[model samples]
Every structure is written in structure tokens, then in C-alpha cells.
Target: MLASPLIEFIAREHPAFVHVPLGLVAALPLAILISFLTKHARPLTGTAFFIAAVGWASSVASLVSGLLWGRQVNLIPVTGYFPVVASEKQVLQKMLQLHITASLVGFVIGGLCTWLLWRAWRREDSPGFAERRHAGRRFWERGAGVPALVVALLWLGSWGFSGKLGGIMVFGNEETNKAAADADRAKRNDAEADLPIRALDYASLEPAGAAPERSKAHGDRWRRIWVTASGIDDYQAGKPMKPGAYAVMATFTDEKGKPGTEPGPLYMKETKADGSTAFLFYWARVPENLRKEVGGQDSVYWRSPDPKLITCLGCHEKDATPAK
Candidate 1:
């Protein structure tokens, strides 16, 4: 059976709901701390309870929405499998764990604080309240003031960390994650840095009057586009293309030409490296995952370990020249 629209909607809208609880939880602790510093517990008791109550309630809603959303997206699969993007699974899983765990912790801490504040209010009305054994105060109650402060701090800290993790997952990878690809990128960057850097002159690729070639390809049907600039003369004449030569390949979708769904980051292929050709891409609009892969800086000229033909084989293989 198909999932409920409401659940899917919640999943799609989790970002919106998640923030409400984060804000409420953050404010609850601040209010409690201010009451302690001011020594004005009486006036702030009701306000603390009010904020805690709302924060707890919203946290419950946020947790429920997150679970339902997970189910909707198969993040927490109920039955059938839902495919995630190949490169994103690990980061997504980590964020999911953090979000759920922290929200539960927040709920528990908020509930306890609310109950203590209620008791504090009740004690204010007892006879000789200020000195009545500090009275009728249990051992735990005697030190409740400090513990309350500690719990509030934990609630704030956990919720904030969880929210930050969620933001990274939604926006892209975080800096500290240890993905294998990241290591590979570092190795590749070090290698590329040692090689000569050459800029391809776009207008010179094709003959002065020749128009650029264009075609549609890719499983998703992204358009296959290219212009042959300079440095391939030997390969064109049945010899190995010299190193440091250049060409440009651009992909576009039929619906929107020029800037396809994924556009720019023009790729420059050098003739040879490590017994195979090498490509360096200058990103116009960086891929979301790429930011994390490169340690937060969107540097130009990403080097791909995979060969150009294999990468573009889906459409360009048929037109490729045979190796000498």
C-alpha cells in the first residue's frame, strides 16, 4: 500500500517543524537561568512552566513528525525499500540518529524541569515558606536548584547539536566526517597541485567558422554537448593525443538548454596522466556533496579518478577514437 499523504507531507516539511521545537527548547533554558540569577523565582515560575510545557509539547510533535517523515522517505523503512542516493546514505543515517536521540533527551529534560517548577510554585504558599526546613523540602529538593540548572543546560546543548547535524545533512556533508572519498580527494589534490596548469581557450577549440557539436544522451537524458578546441591534432590523425591538450564538454537538459538541470563546472581533459588521461573540472555551481568532499572550500579544478570515456560512456563512447 502507498504511504499516507499526511506522512509524506510531514516528511517533506520536517525542516519547518524541526525548527519550532529547537527554538522553544533553546528559550526554556534561558528563561530558567535568568530566574536563578535574578533571585526572582516566583514571578518566573509560571513563565518557566509555560515555556517548558510548550517546548515539551512541540518536541513531541517534532519527534513524531520526524519519524513519520523518515517512514515516508524510507529513512526508517516500515516495509519496502526506498533507494537513497548512492553517495548520501552514510551522512543521512548519522543525522537521523542524532535528531531522534537528541529530541528524546530534550523531552525528558523538559518534563522534569516543568514538574520541578510546579513544585517550587506550590512550596511558595506554605507557611514560613522561606525557612520551613528550607522546609518540607526533600533532600533532592534542597539541591534541585543546581540540578535544574544542569538539566536545562544539557537540554539546550543536545538540542542544538542535533539541529546542527540535521542542517549539515540537509545542506550537505559536514567538515569532520571521514568518508573514504574525501581521502581520495586529498591524495588527488596533492597530485594535481604538482602538475602543470593550463587554461583552455574556448573560442579556439573548433575551427574559426565551425559551429559546436551538440546531442542528447545520458540515462536521465541530459544533453551531450562539446566543442573541440586545441591539442588533439595527433589523436585526430591516429596518434596519441599530446598531454596538456584541451576540450570542453557541456551537458544540458532538453527543457532548458545551456544551463541544464546540472550545468557548468566545465571539464578540461589533459592528454595523459598515471598511464591514463586526466580531467580537471572548474565548478560554476558546485554539487552539494562536493563541498564536504573538498573540506568546505569550493575550489576550482576537481580531478576525477575515473577515466573520461568511462564517465561519459553512456553517450560519447560511440564517437570516441580507437586507441593506437
Candidate 2:
């Protein structure tokens, strides 16, 4: 997954690549104006050259950002995942990589074009300012320059579209969430900070009809769990869990492995909602009833709100606080 460096780069590069090119387009006309008004296009030449330089730099940065983001998202398929039936995923990968590579080439060529335009604007050997202005226009004349311009512009437009999706990857989608994952983590960190050293009375800790909730030292016990979703940052998928979020739910038992009021396996199920879907979940009260283990992948998490992967699907819906 892409990390903070790449994420920040993307957030900054999109806007820069978008606006910088317009300066070049405008500066060409400015060259003609300056020449006619003041008998010289020298200032316009410098302005156009500087803008082109900056534009080229930003363009390359955008190209790199897009590709890195592509790899982060697994936009490219494994060579043998599915058969030769290509999907939109393949098409998107090809288009994105093509634009990224093409943009770099454009940056280089756009630079030379700017330099040429600069030289043309600086040409003032003509009889009068009017004649010099005509010379400035010819400076923009390039060998297949218009076609290259089309490529650059088209690549930039494609960059914008890619950027929209990339933004979703770097920053978590907020519409599914009531608040940010980091904000949820903050609440959990606050909870951990307030965790009492000695256990409180179990009855006092829980509300009526709620099974007693207690905490023991995590003591670095790792559990197996699947990663439901992942992205470059904590915000995207798992951020909702909250800080110090992991917890274990092994069933409580007597020596005979009978039920007791201790930890147990988390059970979850779906609830029907008016439009789409919802969830309900609770702790399994009987230790013997637990399956001994819930199968999961070996997942490494960032600073997360939900540790222990407690938010198992179809199980803990009843236990979760309102997802605010």
C-alpha cells in the first residue's frame, strides 16, 4: 500500500498539473500582444518559459503519483489470476499506465516547445513591432507540435479522472462513515487512557441485560483474523474500529468447559434494513460453544481503532456503538 509520502504527493500534485498548463496556452497569445504593444516579446518569452518549466515538473510528479497509486490498488492484475477474458480492470490499468508514461514524454517535449516559443518571442529583427509579433507566432511553429500538444492535453485530462479515484484511495471514503477513522481512534485512545488498573465491579461496568464486559492484559497475544479491506491509509477501511481497538472474546468456562460469565467468541449476523443492509452481533456466552478459533489471514494493521478484528461481519452488529 502507498504510505504518507505518496499520499501527500498525490493530494498536492493534481491541482498543480491542472492549472500550470493553462499558463502556457495563455502565454503564447501574450507574446503576440507584448510584441505589438511594446515592440518586444522578451518578457512574454520569459514568462512562458518559466510557466512551462513548472508545468513540466508538476506533470512528471503527477505521472509518478498515478502509477504508484495504481500499484497500491492492485489495479494491474496478477499475470494468471483470471483467464484472457480481460476486464475493465485491465483496460483501466493500460490506460492509466499509458497516460502516465505519455505525460512524462510530454513534459520533456513541452519543455522544448516552450524553449522554441521563447526564442521566437525574443526575435525582434523585423522592421516594426507588428512584424516582430508575426515572428513570435512562428516561434510556436513545431515539427508535429500540435499533435504533441493534443497528447499532452489529453493525458492531463485523463490524469484528472484518475486523480478522482486516487483521492478516494489515499483518503478514506467519508460518505460511508459518519466521522473519520482517526476521530474514532481518538475516542478509543481516550477510552484506553481511562481504563482502570484494577477491575471494576462487573455488574457496575455493564448496563442491564448486557453480558459483563471485562478486560485482561493483552500481553502481546496475537490472534488470527482476515483483513476485510485495505488501502494506503488507516482512514480507508479499518479506521472505524477506534484506537486500542483490538480485543479478544474467548468463552468463559469452568474446569469442565461449561459456560460462565467471561469472554467468548464474538458472533455476528445481518439485520434487514429498509433499503440495503445492517448488522447485529453479540458475544458467545459458552466457552465450549466457541469453535476454538475463527479462521483469518495474517494481517498487519496500522495504528487502528479495532484490534482483535472484533468487528466480524454478521456477528457484532448488536454490540457496536452507533457508528458515529
Best by lDDT: 1
Candidate 1 local lDDT, 1-324, one digit each (tens)? 124787677667878987886787678667766655544555665577677677777776677677766765545544312323223424565567666777677678778877876676666555675564443555334322556667767878888877887777667664535554675676687644534234334534543223333443322323332335444465456554455554555444345444346553455555653334555655554556655433343544455442222444343333244432
The most accurate candidate by TM-score is 1
Query: Local distance difference test, per candidate?
Result: 0.56, 0.38
The Cα error of candidate 1 at residue 204, in Å, is: 52
In candidate 1, stretches whose alpha carbon ends up further than 4 angstroms from where it belongs are 1-3, 79-89, 130-144, 174-324
Q: Ten consecutive residues with minimal summed lDDT in candidate 1?
A: 80-89
TM-score, every prediction: 0.46, 0.34
Candidate 1 pairs with clashing backbones: 132-135, 205-228, 205-229
- Give the runs in model 2 whose Cα sits over 4 Å from its true position: 5-17, 21-38, 76-89, 121-324
The Cα error of candidate 1 at residue 74, in Å, is: 1.7
